[model samples]
Target: MEKKCVNEKKCGSCKYLHMTYKEQLKKKEEFVKHELEKCPELKGHFKPIIGMENPWNYRNKVTAVFDRDRKGNPISGVYQEGTHRVIPVEKCLIEDELADKIIGTIRGMLRSFKIKVYDEDTGYGLLRYVLVRRGFATGEVMVVLVTASPIFPSKRNFTNALLKAHPEITTVVQNVNNRTDSLILGDKQQILYGKGYIEDILCGCRFRISPASFYQINPVQTEKLYSKAVELAGLSGKETVIDAYCGIGTIGLIASKHAKNVISVELNPDAVRDAIVNAKVNGIKNVRFYKADAGRFLTQMAEEGAKADVLLMDPPRNGSSEEFLRSAALLGPGKIVYISCNPVSLGRDLGVLKKLGYRAEECWMVDMFPWTAHVETAVLLVRKP
Candidate 1:
């Protein structure tokens, strides 16, 4: 029998908590196989799903919303799915243990600090949410305070208290998000303590992660996923590679060591900035980052008569756009390694790629979100000769 979480029904984060890990893996494998069956080119090319040996507490990034219970005590946890009700979680099974503890400490200190929880309805309070990110290999921690206003009273004392409680914390940043929308972060930010960012090692490559950058939530599976992605690319140190939707240049930098050169592109300026720094930090001189839309960049590369040996694309959950797919064909890379978080979108894109003269040869799944229903996939497609 599988162990159950105390607030399992309310939090609704771990959809497969009731099922054993083996059963969960089987379910995801079957789901991916079923999704891919829609595309004929991908049929009979499915590989076994990669499941984690220890799946619990695998989430490196933890975000909890702040609110007060009826008794006026401060609390922090995730919001109940599809609703605004905040489910008070003392500890979560999927989150990092120390990160969760630090969040709990912050919640406990709110009352003593005379800090008010942000009220969504009345547009009041200081803190709206708390986000914690920990580096698995380096044990570096970054705490981001999402606030309704920039002014934080007694912030110095609060930072000192938090550091005293959890000395492992490397940095603290205050992000002002005063909007009424559901977004977690705002445009404005200020560093309250330490450096504004934290660094971590992935696939022997160091990466700088900021509050807004898109780093994979699961570090353990990320290594497997990225290693497999680069392996499937079949880089020969003589091939030019393109890494699209490259956030902070994680996959690009990892693949750089094996390839002749890598061109990474992202729309977010902050991520592009971090990617450039990450390449320098790793002393990887063969890779360059561009702050442009992936589709547009690929289209221009094709127009410039440039050719790449491999194309590495990790698009959003919605998958790659048709414009990007068409341009990828125009560029005509011999192999295209597509990494996707959503299988349904992956299948749709596979069909589009097949029409554009590419065929999915092999595909594998990595269990990035253990108890959750989500799975990550990497597919290798070769140009149809």
Candidate 2:
């Protein structure tokens, strides 16, 4: 296998744009294992992390900007690194079949309407970017059309045209981003068509996703990730588990049946509301949702004498803050299940936990982001007696 970079030096999305899929997976595995060795307690427990068999076309969502080529043809795709010039990607090897089809369809429609693509230089044009998200379990598609202006009469007509043409699109949201900056999403959103949200089923738990809410992009591998996390938690129906940074309460909802009680903490109010709705939809009553930061919630729980036999932490890519890590270490549950998308940060946090008298008993990796360098990991750490 040879190294392959789709746009070579043009696109910065893929840092390892020059490496083959196999080489990338191998390098990632070695990287995780070597980092684990830095934690003396985790040295022997670290195993060869699993890799995805099909390492291409696995992305469920793609955000592509709109631009124009030298020939004046409307080009809808991502931008080249360090330049506003768009990388005219007719087909992305990392996205699913539906994503590719939708991109092609939208590109043709934009060309037909002669819709002026967003120009970063002059800050003119209506169309800014297209966000496409697909449900892996239900095969539902949500298309969010972001524009620099309101839904003009012509753009509304275009939106109607898309709905009339494609029935697979379950939700169509028009997001207005009138700012001159490069922020893709705005606070204002209006449902243009179909249901306002999409549903995703994981471990028999259904989750509702909004345009701004964060859900696992890879559904198949996310099941594997959550399953591994549950296994590491060692739920026995008698333990209370705290799922920290629990986005939409998927982990807590799924693990509720195995644990006596599940407390889910999330910062986003929308996500918390969605988590409550999901719990009701799934008929889960053992889970509780808290609209608060995970670290603050944990500190409050400690103050209130709320004890948990097991704790699950799934922080964002930036990993847990030092204060959060310190609070988690102070709580010192019997078992800790750490799920991380960034192995480097995972290793660093695991070092903190090890110093707090917790030892890594098991570690596994899930190839959540295929065809990309990102990997998800699950680790079980036990309090040393």
Candidate 3:
């Protein structure tokens, strides 16, 4: 029998914790195959879903909401499913063990430091949320303190105490989120200690990770997922590739080693800056990054008769926009490799691509989130002659 999590029902993050690993993989495979079947042309193309050898404690990133219990004591955990109530979780099977311990230490230190946990009702207190990111390969850790305001009382002392407890922490950042919304990160940020960012190795390349970058949460499976995506591209050292929606240039930098040249584009300035630094750090010169809307940039390139041999896109969970799909078709890449987290949105976008003369050739699933319903998918589409 699987050992059930104490807060499994309340936390509601992992729906398959009770099932065996094999059962979880089978369920996910069936779920993804069913989703792809919605587009008949995409049927019979799904390869075996890749699963992790050790799925527990695979999440390198952890975010917890701050609250006070009836006794007015500080606590930290995730929000309950479909509700704003924070369910305190001391340890999570899917989260990094060190991150959990670090969060526990921070939670305990808040009371002694006279720091008040934020109350959403009256909008009072200092700390709002705590986000921790750990590099599985490098053993580097980052802690982001989400506060309601910039004025942090005894900020130095609090940081010193936290560091004293966990010297493994590489950096500490203060993110001021004064809004009433549910977003964990705010616009304003100041580095409280060390360098503001941490580095991690992915697919034999080092990537600079900032707090807001859209990096994969599970690094172990990420290597496999990206390796499959690159394999599907069939790069022969002569292909010109375009990586759209490129966050910190993870895929582009990885693909650059094989392709002749890679063009990567993203809208976020912070991400673009980090991507440039990442390229420099990795000493990769063949890939170039642009801070522009991917769809618009590709459309302009297509209008200029610029051509690419392959197009790689890893859009958000909502999937790529129709504009981006149309522009992708306009660019007329011989092959398209799409990495999607949401199967429904992927099906919808696949149908759009089908009408644009692209046919789904093969699809592979990577179980990045082991216990959760969410699964990462990579699909290869070829332009029909």
Candidate 4:
């Protein structure tokens, strides 16, 4: 029997809570298989879907928006899907227990510190959103208070109160978002406590996770996913690997162990910085980090006559762009490992890559996100002879 979620409709986080856990995984696996079947090169190549033992509370990061209710009381939670109305979640089954408690505690301190929730209409308030990131392996936590402006009234007292309540919190940061736009994080940030970032171990590598670093939410499955991706690359300790869209160099660093060298490219300069630091911290000498557009970098590599034996790409939910596929085709890597969050976009991109002399070999579904419509699919593409 499926466990009914209390905040399913209002929270808008889990889309498949009504179905049993088994049904959820099966549905996701079938969905990926169905999408990949459209491409002739991907037919009958999907491996068994990897399901989680205990999928609840797997998310390491939680983002809560602050707003006012109809009665003008401060509220915090996720917006109701596509709107600005905060859902006011007291307890979420999927969220980390301590992180939710901290957010709830901060919500209570709003009145004590004279903090006003930001208003999207008037844009006159201070508090905007609360972001909490936890290190699954290290038991360290980072709290980021998103504010409309740098001026936080009684900021010292507020942070002290939060730390006193949650002694396990490692860091507290205040990020200012003066714009009226929908971005959750701002440019300017100040550390109110501890280091501005937390650390976590994934696949035997230590990674520094900042308030904005792109660490995987599901740490356990992340190890499995990266391991599988590296396995599919079939490195012989002599191959040159290119990690594209490499946020924090998670995949690139992991691949460094098996490959001779790794070149990781990311668009975000901040993530690239963290990736560089992560490589040094992990004592990995063979991986190089580059802050550039992955497509343009691959194109440049092609123009320079540099050859990559394997191209490991973990694109965003929207998947890789056609330009990237063309660039990848020009580079002519022997094997291309694609990690995708959206199977539809993966299939669409695979079609484009097929025209680039790449044949899809094996696809596997790894359920990093449970009770949700989202699934991670890893596919290996071998260049056709």
Q: Which ten residues in a row have the lowest lDDT in candidate 1?
A: 37-46
Q: Summarize candidate 3's per-residue lDDT along 1-385 as a digit string, tens digits.
A: 3767988888788999888988999998998888877567666677899999888899999999999988888889998888988888899988999999999999999988999999999999999999999888999999999999999999999999999999999999999999998778999999999898898999999998999888899999999999999999999999999999999999999999999999999999889999999999999999999999988998899889888899999998899889889988888899999999999999889989998999998999999999898999999999999
What is the C-alpha local distance difference test score of each model?
0.93, 0.81, 0.92, 0.90
Give one digit per residue, the lDDT tens place, for model 1 in 1-385.
4666989888878989989999999999999988888567667778889998889898899999999899978889989988999999988888999989999999989989999999998998999999999999999999999999999999999999999999999999999999999999999999999999999999999899999999999999999999999999999999999999998999999999999999999999889999999999989999988999999999999999988889999999999999999999998899999999999999999989988988889999999999899999999999989
Ranking by lDDT: 1, 3, 4, 2
**Model 4, runs deviating above 4 Å:** none
Off by over 4 Å in 1: none
Could you give candidate 2's per-residue lDDT for residues 1-385 as a string of tens digits?
A: 4436567566766666567666777777877887777576566676676666766677878788888888877887777888777888767667777877787788789867767877778888888888988888888999988888885447677877787777788988888888877788887878888787888898888889877777887777888889889987878899888899988889898899899999899998878888999999999899999999888888877777767789998999988987777677677689999999988899888888878888888888777876567888898989889
Strongest candidate by lDDT: 1
lDDT of 2 at 236: 87
TM-score of each: 0.98, 0.93, 0.98, 0.98
Compared with the true structure, what per-residue lDDT tens digits does model 4 show for residues 93-187? 77888899999999999987888999888978999999999999999999999999998888998999999999999999999999877888998
Off by over 4 Å in 2: 1-9, 14-22, 82-84
Pairs that collide in candidate 1 are none
- For model 1 the local lDDT of residue 264 reads 95
